[model samples]
Target: MPGGRPPSLRTVASWILTHPDALPEKERLKLKSVLAGCPELDALAEHVRSFGQMLTQLRGERLPEWIAAVRADDLPILHTFANGLERDLAAVTAGLSLPWSSGIVEDHVNRIKMIKRQIYGRAGFKLLRKRVLLAS
Candidate 1:
């Protein structure tokens, strides 16, 4: 916890969920003791684990129930996440259920943005279009 470069909250959560055993022995022991000492933390961990399982398994049908449970649990951060997910429920469900991903499309968009930045104030539309086509 006290280091020049400490791990992020997301990193710590990921470590706890995906690779706790890979953590250093002292850190792992501390994590285990902390979790064992807190019932709320244990329950939250179980909730997150179940959500992760649903995501990995592409069980979009379970999302509504999961959101409800999160809301009922009154975890402020998770409740905010649930609310955002609810706002984009359709897109979230599609992402969970579909085998396809938008990663390639997003990559292309990012490349285009990079190219635009590189050519900003130095190029016209036609030249930029040509560069984009050629690059692709």
Candidate 2:
């Protein structure tokens, strides 16, 4: 707030989500200061870090406990997210527990969509089809 610009939302978000051991001293200090100033934020950060661990470690079995912990707190946004997960618990758990991902299929679909948009109004179905096939 004095000599330089404050960190952007993305920067601060990374600091919170990133493992503390990996952070440089300066960024860690900033994160500490921010967390110390707000108990709610500190709690949220702890819960988020735990959730991040669950994701990275493929510990989907911990989801229920995590949801309970989140609901115990006053963080409404996180509560909403947890609620959404509850509605489709099986799919979410399977996604977290499994090593496989549908990302490649999703990416291919996105590429096709992009190619279609790029060729829109510039060509007919034939040209669009050629480009899409070439893109594959």
**Which candidate number would show the highest lDDT if scored against the true structure?**
2
| Residue-by-residue lDDT tens digits, candidate 1, 26-91 | 767656665676667666776787788777888878889988888878578888988899998999
Query: Which candidate should be chosen as best, given TM-score against the real structure?
Result: 2
Write one digit per residue (lDDT tens) for candidate 2, span 1-136. Answer: 3357777778878999899999999999888877887799899999989988889999999999999999999999999999999999999998888899999999999998999899889989999889988887
Give me the displacement of residue 53 in model 1, in angstroms.
1.4
Clash-forming residue pairs, model 2 = none
Q: Estimate the TM-score for candidate 2.
A: 0.88
Q: Which run of 10 residues does model 1 get worst, by summed lDDT?
A: 1-10
lDDT, residue 43, candidate 2: 93
Overall lDDT per candidate, in order of appearance:
0.78, 0.91
Distance from true position, residue 87, model 2, in Å?
1.4
Clashes of each: 0, 0
